[model samples]
Target: MTESTHAPLLTVRGLTRRVGTRHLFDIAELVFRRATAVALTGVNGAGKSTLLRMIAGLEPAPGATVTWTEADGTPRTTPLTPLPQALRRQVAYMHQHPYLFRTSVRDNIAYGLRARGLPHDEINRRVGAALGWAGIVHVQDTAPDKLSGGEIQRVALARAKVLEPELLLLDEPTSSLDGHAREQVIALISELAAEGRCVVMVCHDRELINLPGVVRWKLGEGQLDTKHR
Candidate 1:
């Protein structure tokens, strides 16, 4: 792990995981910072997504421990592994093929807020802002399943944004996108990083990996290697 004077946004220790008989990762200590975009690249089945899932607390491996220091200097541990339902709102994971419910785009964006028991009016306010932010307000009333691949990507990102997450995990945001869609997702990523939202994304696209000011890392042989700025 790289050394930094500032405190990390999140820290993982004694983490180990495996799929069947193949070993995935055995990380001792890794620190993630805020307002940064991490582009993780590796060969197929190199455990890129596995690492993201672990951090998202979706799958907790044995001997794994995750922690983060609160703004008040208090540490949160129990709710670390297998992350609590409430904390999940602050740390979200987006798969390459995001699932869209049968509802309108606006409803889909507001789903998480609704689950959190936000008022109806508040949900509408946030959802409307998110749609405009993603430049998809025109299709706010459209069925999610009817959108194009790029539109779906934007909506998925907008979903993540509406929650005001401190950490956003993305898996191959541009893997299925065409040139234009790729550009759109890339632009959004830039904005997210600028907003100081910690973003860890799994992607191998040269266009994205070469993006200025992003932390480039390689995941191979169950290790994380810093390769760029």
Candidate 2:
């Protein structure tokens, strides 16, 4: 979809994070647009990951107010300290080194659906589709220990994709990849953005930051500088 057709998916105001007397970032306002991807860049110790975690509801942002726009255009606003369950259901967060279950790749991909109590048939269907979508169908029965770094990342992505989240938060997704593996992950990220999801990625990789049509947001000196809005 084109930028012109994109709508506001989430908005944040009065966001702040701090460690004792050290301020990480203090943003007055920020907006995440649907069908768009944002590459969040910053120097070491700039709290890029912290901000992402807060958005994913994995961290506390007592001063922040998050507003999510639902499919029917209903706006729901809440404090970041205790993000509502409704918001958590629509956001998915992926770590740079994703943790996988001890079971088979397919089982790992199906974990989320099982957690949500999806019907057996529907879970199976979604798991199968996620495996194929992530190009890991061949390793459906393989254990996590046997998979390579790239394969592990793919499996993690499939796990998240199966849930069909509205907002995807990725923290340095390609940091440990190289060659074909890096390319594969990059391609998957692009596909995710193309599907009309709001993708917020924290990375220092120039290639990912420069991905076609990715909006860049840099955090430094307790402020966020956004490029291309």
Candidate 3:
């Protein structure tokens, strides 16, 4: 497909979510352009996490259509009530804290591929490459719980990256990291976007507001506004 045919990698229309009297995201429509990184910025309780979760299909959000297109040109929209299993596998969401399996870091990265019927050798190769990309190769065989906060988060990202999802949803991926670790995480995200993966990150920091080639969207008072740069 040419650049002109690069339709939105993700589209949300008339999205709304509420927890009792609290309104999270009341977006009318939002489109995440193909091969671009988009940052969701707002205050602490401005529904950043909630919006990411909705896009990832982790929870029920109201009146929204979430669609993802594969490189092969197949596209799928969100289904009512029950989400298709194939769509679920095409989207990966990373939480603030990486939840590692009881097994080694390698096993955690291989979990998704194993479930998808990939061979053991393929899983090993993919996991190794992902670990190297995330810059956590030194701890490939170590247990996750014993790793630092940044290490754990990187491992989680490695796991998701190995799956090669069409869309990646991140919620505060660098929240618990120090200066150097934070930069590493941000750089990794930039690299992913450059590789033509659609990325949506929930961030409160100002540094991301001016990230090169990133579309910034802010949520406030139950509204969504674009601060395109």
lDDT top scorer: 2
**Ranked by lDDT, top first:** 2, 1, 3
Candidate 2 has an lDDT of 0.89
TM-score of each: 0.93, 0.95, 0.89
Ordered from best to worst TM-score, the candidate numbers read 2, 1, 3
Considering every candidate listed, which one attains the maximal TM-score?
2
Candidate 3, position 104, lDDT:
91
**Model 1: per-residue Cα lDDT over 1-229, one tens digit each:** 1223546778877877788987777778777788888898989998889888888887775676667776688987653466765467679899989999999998899999999899999998999989988989999999987899999999999999999998899999999998887898899988987887788899988888877777887888977786544
Root-mean-square deviation per candidate: 2.3, 1.5, 2.7
Candidate 2 residue-wise lDDT at 45: 94
Residue 76 of candidate 3: its Cα lDDT? Answer: 70
Give the local distance difference test score of model 3: 0.79
Q: For residue 161, what is the lDDT in candidate 3?
A: 93
lDDT of 3 by residue, 1-229 (tens): 0123567766667789887988766777777765777788878888888777777777776567766676587887774224456667768999887678899988899999999999888988999899899999899889977888878888888899999987899988887887877888888888888888888888765665467777887788888887643
What are the lDDT figures for the candidates, one per model? 0.84, 0.89, 0.79
Lowest-sum lDDT 10-residue window in model 2: 1-10
lDDT of 3 at 34: 57
